[model samples]
Target: MAKTKAAAENESQLADPSVDRKALLSEALRRRIVSMEMAPGAVVDELALSEEFGLSRPPVRELMRQMAAEGYIELEANRAARVSSMNHQSLRNFFLAAPLIYIATTQLAAIHATHAEIDELKAIQQRFREAIEQNDVENRVLYNDQFHLQIGKMAHNPYLMPSLRRILIDHARLGKIFYRHPTTHDMEADLGKAAGQHDQIIDAIARHDAQAAGDIVRAHMDLSRRRMTEYVAPVGVEVPLAF
Candidate 1:
C-alpha cells in the first residue's frame, strides 16, 4: 500500500539533517495521533519508524515506551504498539472523571501556584488566543494541552498529576473535533468563551481563591462538552432523501 500524504510529509521532515530526529518524530506522532491523522487505535509500526528516522529498533521501542507512559500509545507483550483507543467505555469514563480531576487540579493550583507559574500559564494562554485568532487548529490543540498540563504541575499533587495528565490526552483529542472543524456559529463563540475562562482561571488562582477556580473550571468543562455535542449533533434542517 502507498503511504498517505501525512506519512510522506513526516518522512520528508525526518530527512532533515539539521533537526533532532527523535524529538521531531515524537512531536509529529503526538500531533498526528491527537489530531486523528493517525486515528485512535492505529498500529504504530516500529520498523517503519526506525527505517524512516534512521534509528535503531531499541531507540524506536524506547520512544514508543515513553509515549505509552504518557498515555499517547499503548504497548503489549508480543504485539505492536497502538495509539490509545477512545472507545465508548473510555469516553464514558472520561466524562465521569475529567471534571473531577480538572476541578481538583485547578483548586489546588489556586492554593499552590507560584507567581512565576502563573506567569507561565498566562504565556501559554496568550499563544492559545493567537491560535484561536488564526484558526490554527493544530497549535490550538497543542497549546491547550500545554495550558492544562501547566495547571497540573502547579497543582503539586503527585497523586492527581498522573490522572490529570492522562485525561488531558483525551481532552486534546476530543477537542480537535470542535477546534479543527467548527461547523456552527456556537463553536466559534465557545472558543472565545474558553479563552475568557482561561483568564478567569488565572485571576482566581492568582488570588488564591480555590472555590472560584473550581467554579470556573466547572464552567470550562461545560463549555467544552457543549461544543463537542454541537459538533456531533449539529442543529440544522431535515436530512436530504431521494425516493
Candidate 2:
C-alpha cells in the first residue's frame, strides 16, 4: 500500500496536463522539422495535423501559426505552409542569438535550481542516457529538451524562460537535421559526445558552481557549432534542401 501510494503521488507532481499538452505539440513539430520528417521546404498539411492530433483546425492552425511566427515555418504565397529552410545567413543569425541567452539562463539556474529540481534533472539525464543507448533519435530529442527546460524553469526568472524555450526550439530543429548527414568523422552521427556533455553540465549544477555551469554550456554550444559546420551553407546562400 505504501509503494502504491508513493507511485501515485509521484505521478501527480509531473507537469500540468495543459502545459504538457502544449509542450507536446510544440516539441513534436520542432523535432519533426529538424529531422526532416516534416522536411524543409515541404508544405505542412494542416488538415493532416489536425486529424492526427484529433484537434480541430482552429487550435491546430493557431499552433502552426505560432510556430511559423517563430521562424520555424514558411507560409507560401498561396497560403500553404512548410518548414523554413535556413541558409547560411539565417542559420548564422540563429546560432548567434542562442549562446548569449542560453548561458545566462543556465547560470541563473545553477544559482537557483533547488535540490529537488537537481534530482529531477538527474532522472531526466538517466532517461537521456537510455535513449542514447537505444539510438532513439526522436525520443532522445524530447528528453534532451526535458533536461534543459527543467533547468530553465529552476532559474526562477519568468522572463528568461520564454527566451530559453525559443532557443531550444530552434536548436532542436538544427541539431536533429544536422545529424542526419553529420560530419564524416562521426560517420554514424551518434550524439554520444553531446549527451556526455549533459552529464558534465549536470555535475557542475549539482556542485552549484555557477561559473562552471556557464562554461560547460559554452562548451556544449561550441561543440554543436563544430558538428554543424559541415552542413552550413556559404554566407548569403540558401539551400533548397537539407538532409
Candidate 3:
C-alpha cells in the first residue's frame, strides 16, 4: 500500500503542469554549459542560480552536485562548482575514447532497441534535419545530442551509459564550435552527410544490424573529427622546414 501510494504521487507529480525547480535549474545550466555560453571551466554561481530559479541555496547546491556527477560540472570541497573543463588532456582523451564508446553503444542499441525507441529516434532525426534546414546551430547540436542519448539509453547498459554521457557533453560542446563557424568548412555537404547518416543509423538499429550500426557510428565520428581538426587548424602560412 505504501509503495502504491508513492508511485501514485510520482505519477501525479509527472502530470503536474509546473516543472520541478531542480529539474528546471539543471536543464538551464546544462544548456548554458553545452552551448558554450558558460564556457569550459566557468564558475557556477549558486546564488545566481538560486535567484533565477526562486529556490534556496541548499536545493541549488544539490542541483550542482547532480550536474557534477553527470560530468557537466565539477565540485570541490571548498569552492563553487565549475563547468567541466575541456583542456588539452581532456580533449585528447575525448578524441581517443569517443569512437569506441559510440560504436559500442550504437551496436548494443541495435540489438536491444524496441519499436518505441526506434520511433523516438526517428522523431529526433526529423527535428535534427529541421535544425539543419533552419541553420539553428544550438538546436542542431542539441537535437544531435538527444539523438545519440536516446540510442545510449536503448543500449540499456549501465556501465556504458555513464561514460557515453560524459563523452557526449564534450561532443556537444565541440559541435557548437563546429556549427557556429560555418565558413570554416563546406557546411551544406557536411551537414547533408550527417543527416543522411542519421537516417542510416536509425535504419540499422531498426533492422537490428549491429555491425552496420557500428560501422556507421565510426564513420560519423571520423567525419566529425576531420571537420573539427580542419576548423582548429586551417591551412594558411607555410611552416619553416628548418627549426
Candidate 4:
C-alpha cells in the first residue's frame, strides 16, 4: 500500500501543471542571460548553483550545457562554463541574417497558412499591443517573439525552424537594450507604429500577398536594426538598477 501511494504521488506530480523541471531551469537561465544578471563572459559557478537549487551538480551542468548550445553561454578555458559576450560584428551579422530568414518563413506562411493560423497570429499581436501599452515591455517582447514564431510555425518547414528560432531570439534578447532608449525621432509618440506593421503583415498574409508580407516584415526589421544601432550603452553598463 505504501509503495502504491508513493507511485500515485509520483504520477500526480508528473501530471501536475506546474511540474516541469527542464522548463523551469531553462526559463531561469534565459532570464538571467537576458537581463544581464549573469554578466557576459563571467564564469557560471556550477557548484554554487547546485547548492542553492538543492539539486545535484549533474542537473545544473545539464542546464549549463543547454544554455551553451543555445549560444547564451560558452565553454571557456579548460571547460569552464561562462556566459557569452556581445560582439558588434556578430550582432550585425545576426541582424542581417535574421530578417532574411524570418521573411522567407513569413512568405511561406502567407502562402500556406490556414484561416485559424492567421487568426492565432492576430491574437498574439493583439495581446502584444496591449502589453506594450501597459508598459509590460517584458511580456511584450515575449509575445512579440511568439507572433513571429507563429509565422514560422505556419510555414510547416521543419528544416527552417531551428535557424529561425535562434536568430529571432538573439534579436529578442537585444530588446532589453532597445526598449530603454529614448526614441530618436518621435517613434515612441507612435507606440502604434509597431502594431500597425504587425497588422499590415497579417493583412498581407490573409490576402495571400506573400511578396508584400515579406517586404513589410523586412521593413520592420530594418527599422529595428536602425534604431538598435542608435542604442548607446546607457552610460557605462553599471549593475542594472533593477532589484
Candidate 5:
C-alpha cells in the first residue's frame, strides 16, 4: 500500500519538530476551502480532520471554531461543521460590501502602515508574483489572500479588520472560479494586471498616499469583478450574468 501525495506531505510535516501543527492545519483547511476542494456548504467532519491531521479532538475543534469565526465554516449544535454557503443573497451582500471595505481598509492602511509592515507586504507580494508566474492556482489564491490580509493588519482598524477577513473568505472561494480552469487570454491579461496592481498598492501604502491606495484598490476590485464576471458568463454565452 502506497501513501498518497497528500498523505506523504502530511507525514513529512508531522515529522518536522519545528513545525507548528496547528498553524499547518489551519493553513491546509484554508487552502482547501479557498481552492474549492471543500466546496461551499460541504460538511467538515471533526473526527476525520482529527485523524487526517494527526491532531487531537481539542485542537481540531479549536481550529474549527477559529475557522467559523473567520467565515470559512458554519457550526451548529449536534451537526458537523460546514463551509460557508454562497448563494444569491450572500453573493449580493458580498458585492455590495467588498469594494467599500477594500477601499476603506486600503486607505486606512496607507495612513497607519509601519515600515516593517510594508516590508512584510513586499515579501508576500513576491510570493504572489511567483505563484502567478508558476500558474499554481491554489498558491495564487492563497498568497493573494495573504497579501490582502497583511494590508488589513496594516489598516489597524478594529471595526474594519473583521469585515475584511470575512469578505476575503468569499473572495478566495469565488476566486477559484476566476483563477482556475479559465485559460482565456483575458484571464491571463487580468492576472498580469492584478500582480502589477499589487505592486502599485504596496507603493501607495509605502508612500502613505491614502488617496492613491484607495484608487488603486478600486481598480483592483474592478479587475476582480470583471474577471469573475467573464468566467461566469463567457463571450460565447447569449446572456452574460453580471457579478
Candidate 6:
C-alpha cells in the first residue's frame, strides 16, 4: 500500500504544470540567445520576460542570474542584464583564443572520451547535417555549438571546460551571421565538407588519436573563420568615378 501511494505521488508530481515552468523558461531563453533572436548586447528586460513566461519577477531574475553566470549575458551594477556582446575587441580575442582552446580541449577529448560520448557526438552531427540540408540556419548554428560543447564535456577537464564554454557562446553568435547569409556558389557543398570534418573528428577521438584530433579541430576553426570573414566584408571591384 505504501509503495502504491508513493508511485501515485510521483505521478502527481510529474503531472504538475508549475514544476516545469522554470526549466521551460530557461530553455526558451537559451534557444533565443543561441539562435541570435536575442541579439548580442541587447538589453534583457526582466519584467518583460516575467510576463512572457507567465512567472513572477523573482524567478525571472533568478533565471537571468543563472544565464549570466553561464556566459550567456552580462550583468552590471545599476543596469539591466545585457546579452553577451561581440564587439570588435571581443571578436579579435575570440579569433586569437578559439584555435588554442579548441585544440587543447579536442586533444583531451580524444584522450578521455568514452564510447557513449562519441555516440552522442554522432547523433549531434546527424542533426547538424539535417539542419544544413533543410537550410535551418538557427539549428545549424545551435547543433554546431552542441557538437563542440559535447567534445568539451568529453575532455572532462575542469580548467578547460569553462574556457570552452565561454568560447562557444561567442562562437555560436558569430556563426549565426555565417549561416544566415549563404552566398557561396556551393553553400551545400561547404556544409557537406564541414559535416565530413565532424565525422573525421569523431573517428579520431574514438581512436584516441590526440594529434589527429587537434589537427582536425584546427582545420575546422579555420573553415569557420574563413566563412565568417567572407560575410564580414565581401570583396568587390572598385569603380572609378569621374572627377
Would you give me the overall lDDT of model 1? Answer: 0.88
lDDT of 1 at 160: 97
Q: Lowest lDDT 10-mer window, candidate 4?
A: 1-10
- Superposing every Cα of model 4 onto the true structure, what RMSD results? 8.7
Angstrom error at residue 36, model 1: 2.4
Off by over 4 Å in 5: 1-6, 16-23, 236-243
User: What TM-score would each prediction reach against the true structure?
Assistant: 0.86, 0.73, 0.87, 0.79, 0.86, 0.87
The residue-level lDDT of candidate 2 at 82 comes to 80
Q: RMSD for all candidates, in order, please.
A: 3.6, 9.4, 8.2, 8.7, 4.3, 7.7
* Model 3 ranges off by over 4 Å: 1-19, 238-243
Q: Model 4, 5-104: lDDT tens per residue?
A: 4335544654666776555556666766765667667888888766544457888888888777778788766877877776777687888788888799
Predicted candidate 3 versus true structure: per-residue lDDT over 63-149, tens digit per residue: 788888989999989887899999988988999999999999999999999999999999999999999888888889999999999
Sequence-dependent TM-score of model 5: 0.86
Which residue pairs in model 4 clash with each other?
A: none
Q: Lowest-lDDT window of 10 residues in candidate 2?
A: 6-15
Overall lDDT per candidate, in order of appearance: 0.88, 0.74, 0.88, 0.77, 0.88, 0.86
Please, what are the lDDT tens digits per residue for candidate 1 over residues 102-189?
Answer: 9999999999999999999999999999999888888899899999999999999999988888898899889886577765587788
Pick the winner on lDDT between candidates 3 and 4: 3
lDDT of 3 at 74: 91
Better TM-score candidate (1, 3): 3
By descending TM-score, how would the candidates be arranged? 3, 6, 5, 1, 4, 2
Q: Report the lDDT tens digits of candidate 2 across residue range 194-234.
A: 87778888888888898998998898888878767755543
